[model samples]
Target: MQDKYATLAPALDSPANEGFAITPSDSSDLQQVTRALYVGEGGDLAVEMRDGASLTFKDVPQGSILPLRVRKVLQQTTAAYLVGLC
Candidate 1:
């Protein structure tokens, strides 16, 4: 049988793109999102969607990877290390 989901590798220590760092004032613009995101350990983060809606993830533990099963275009983050892949 075919796999339900594809495997994903771990997030890198450095930023993936130029706008990887999500700041307080300016929101980071993300590329085309093909798969879910894997968030690494860091402070609380806020994910902004293209439609101006937002979601906040509080106090995520270090080394934890979250599988956010959303296909919306990501606008930015508050403060968290993340990896995006399938």
Candidate 2:
């Protein structure tokens, strides 16, 4: 397979080439830091940032795509069907 963008360095604004399902957990860290998060079923999305700051985005609408660098999705997250873009 030929990837036209493969030679380009990945920047924060670059398109994500990988994605994984996210399971919110307080004890476990994500296998990799996410470049963004896809909110399939949204409400309150709590997450720990790459810098280790914890935050919760309230009233996130369903099917929203959040461009965030996340380290972990906290157990307190009310959102469901989360996918991590890397």
Candidate 3:
């Protein structure tokens, strides 16, 4: 499963390949994500996708998708996001 989200580096490893990539779990879903907790935005996300195993966002005209089950797992444990941060 970890291999699936190759771009999602471990919290103790490297930052996400993309501006907003997954990091090792500092919260509940450690196995799914990485150091999203350390994000300058002050973490805390509400990922609703379970088996969806994929997340979506617009990189502009074209969109992108990421591993959801993994993302949700990490989001469960990350620090709560600060107000007005995202």
Candidate 4:
């Protein structure tokens, strides 16, 4: 199939062309940094940003799409079934 936007530069708001399941871990980083995260379940989410800053998002709703550039999903995250969009 031909992609009309193939030549366009990808921005944060651009649709994701690739995705991978995310497992929260304290010692491991994701194979690829995410442009966004798909939350299949709701809860507090702790993550390490691409810039190496750590933070937590509280009370994230289920099925929410968070536009974040994260390198790691920390074990402190309570949310489940995370898919990293890249």
Best-performing candidate as measured by TM-score: 2
Cα-based RMSD of candidate 3:
13.9
- Model 3 segments beyond 4 Å from truth? 1-16, 20-38, 53-86
What C-alpha lDDT, on a 0 to 100 scale, does residue 59 get in candidate 3? Answer: 25
- How do all models score by TM-score? 0.46, 0.95, 0.18, 0.94
- When 3 and 4 are scored with TM-score, the better candidate is 4
Candidate 1 lDDT, 54-75, residue by residue in tens = 6777776666555543334233
Residues 4-49 of candidate 4: C-alpha lDDT, one tens digit per residue = 9999999888899899999999999999999999999999999999
**Candidate 3 lDDT by residue in tens digits, 1-86:** 36666765455344344333344343443333322322323333444343534343222121222323333433352333211100
Q: lDDT values of the candidates? A: 0.47, 0.94, 0.34, 0.96
What local lDDT score does residue 19 receive in model 2, on the 0 to 100 scale? 99
True lDDT of residue 10, candidate 1: 35
Off by over 4 Å in 4: none
Off by over 4 Å in 2: none
| TM-score winner between candidates 1 and 3 | 1
Candidate 4: minimum summed lDDT over ten consecutive residues — where?
Answer: 8-17
The stretch of ten residues in a row with the least summed lDDT in candidate 1 is 14-23
Candidate 1 colliding pairs: none
